[model samples]
Target chain A: MTGGYGLLVADLIGVAVFAASGASAGVAKRFDLFGVAFVGFAAALGGGIARDLVIGAVPPLAFADWRYAVTAVLASVAVFWLHPKLHRVRRTVLVLDAAGLGLFTATGTLKALDAGVPPVGACLLGMLTAIGGGLTRDLLTGEIPIVLQRDIYAVVALGGAILVTIGHRLGLTGLGPLVTAAVLMTGLRLLALYRRWSAPVAVP
Target chain B: MTGGYGLLVADLIGVAVFAASGASAGVAKRFDLFGVAFVGFAAALGGGIARDLVIGAVPPLAFADWRYAVTAVLASVAVFWLHPKLHRVRRTVLVLDAAGLGLFTATGTLKALDAGVPPVGACLLGMLTAIGGGLTRDLLTGEIPIVLQRDIYAVVALGGAILVTIGHRLGLTGLGPLVTAAVLMTGLRLLALYRRWSAPVAVP
Candidate 1:
């Protein structure tokens, strides 16, 4: 597949995983079906929408493309009905979430760069795209964002984005650098989880 | 002043008030100066950014205009330094918040209508504009949104937006209907607060 097509596929998978996570959160909160769907869609699209808006991309692709909405809603409905079974595979979900984070960071950075954003701004936008969905989900569920509370989540995304931005600046084209950066990001995030590594809370 | 210029001035005033409210919340949470300023800017611009994105307005005015940023920052700094004295006049802040809500709703609805949105969609956008900032503030502070919890806040904004949309459809142009709608909305919100009125919670 072409590089662009590969990125699109990765983005859709990321959306599905994020939607499932959001729907799970909604179910845990005892939200009704509509609420679950709303949360799921927000989690899937919020990051992309924010990125698009900041870059002056009108009518965010998530809103314009029917496929995104359909995918998110399907994921949400599946979680709503099959959560008990899904809950048994908590480890799988965590792994998929790491993958999603990596995919979004990579793609978001590339998009921002394509829009002529400077490297540093692109890196921040990439991190925002990785975390914004989960932030919106947590906010909708009335909880402090886990990103702000635990782990090196956002930092990991930023690290991946930096790699991508540097690769692009070095004339590394196509899926080679993108895939490498994504895999590295996912692996590092998993390692962080396994090692119980976390960012510091506050200064003494 | 022309209607558009008047709207711009009203929007700047709304930004200042919303920034102050957000800064006050940050102070209550004991956030540092930077955090308070960040929250202030977010509250001032979040609603307009959301509205601009939804309507396909590239480069949201809040981000493009230096005046908006300067106004919000000034308001935040003022509040950060003068909060103790400002707190003595709690009623004034409440009244200003109502006026901000009304002004945003009116202007948001008009902007949506100008963008060719249908009446219902415009009204919803207007309500979103009125409440989105406060919702962001509450989320950042780790609290449930007041609009969703208690009070007729969103509903009041929607009412004013509906009136503005109706007026526009009737070919009532200029600042006349917009000002009237805003005044009516502010009055109703104040009355609702005084009378302890609130939207219903979930059904029993």
Candidate 2:
């Protein structure tokens, strides 16, 4: 189980990264400030909300927790003001995106398991939690989902979620297991991004 | 206060219309079959799922009832195979879309009221239930949501939902009230479409 403070901190960081990513897309699209914030909020919180709703966690944690919403808003504002500087740091963006994916995958899987979801379902939910936010951002911007179009993104999320689910099932539910799972996921994502690894497409 | 069989029939028709709408968009975008089916399913069912989750209903009714899914799939396949002929019947699509908005608004409001949501919240959720599916479909297809950009669409939904909520509060939760609310909403939508009425936009 993740310590409460540790999980909160990780979640906030993930929200910031996801929000910043969404804000960048909004800026690129020349959306107004309200549109930018809307996309940013959706990207930061949509995944967690989707997972919670599926698991019958009403009002989703993000809705209940002011801090998560504030973090996303802060990220959105920062991106709006400093996007030029943020855009220059390509590597940082990549790393943060990867880290967010890992963190959400771990957290989502654990939450589902705690809610009595079976392992397979928990793993799928975990993957959804990791990818759903970015999917929302891309969709709001009227783009084909990056996860579906290319790269080894969803596979990395699935791999991380599977590991976390298995570890929890094996009585390895400590912070150590969570950290290990997240790190593995993040590393794989970064490697895939760097190597230009892509998922196989159907022969259409 | 809805009769179960009557509500079910209305829901099935709404689902068919929403799915057909989503599939036409997918066909226009030249998405693959999976993409077409995905949008169709989301457009048919996403709104009800959103409403149910907000009211703490687990496993939204659409998920529990296989018929809704089947209706969406049938509509998607129909659009896939017969889009050319279907597209020729533009007026039919418009009428179905209006009918769907009206039906979902009434049903959503009634359901929320039954769940004990406050009148205003119930009204909002009802509107969400009417528009969330198309919002999702538009976002998935990479378009600014029609509800957001166009003529008085969501406003009409909100009006219908409000009427239902107020009627229920006034102890007028009968078939007559429901039908009246729905007809008014549908008529407004159709009038707006025909009259070229548009929502106010910011002067940029």
Looking at model 2, give its docking quality level.
incorrect
Clash pairs for candidate 2: A1-A173, A142-B142
Candidate RMSDs in Å, in order, are 6.7, 6.5
Clashes in model 1: which pairs? none
In model 2, which regions exceed 4 Å deviation?
Answer: A1-49, A58-131, A137-142, A147-204, B200-204
lDDT of 1 by residue, A1-204 (tens): 225666777778899999999999999999999999999999989999889888887678888878889999999999999998996889998999999999899988888888876676677678889889998998899876666555778879988998998999999868888888999999999999999987533231
* Candidate 2: C-alpha RMSD after superposition: 6.5
TM-score, each model? Answer: 0.60, 0.62
Write model 1 residue lDDT over B19-123, tens digit each, in one string: 999888877776555556657877988898789888877556664566887788789878878887886889998998999999899988998989989999999
Score each candidate by Cα lDDT: 0.85, 0.85
- Looking at model 2 chain A, report the run of 10 residues with the lowest lDDT sum: A195-204
How would you encode candidate 2's per-residue C-alpha lDDT over B1-204 as one tens digit per residue? 456788779879999999999888877777655557657878998899899888977656664556887799789877877887875798988998999999899989998999999999999999999999999888888788888876888999998888888788789976778878988999999999999998889999
On a 0 to 100 scale, what is the lDDT of residue B199 in model 1?
78
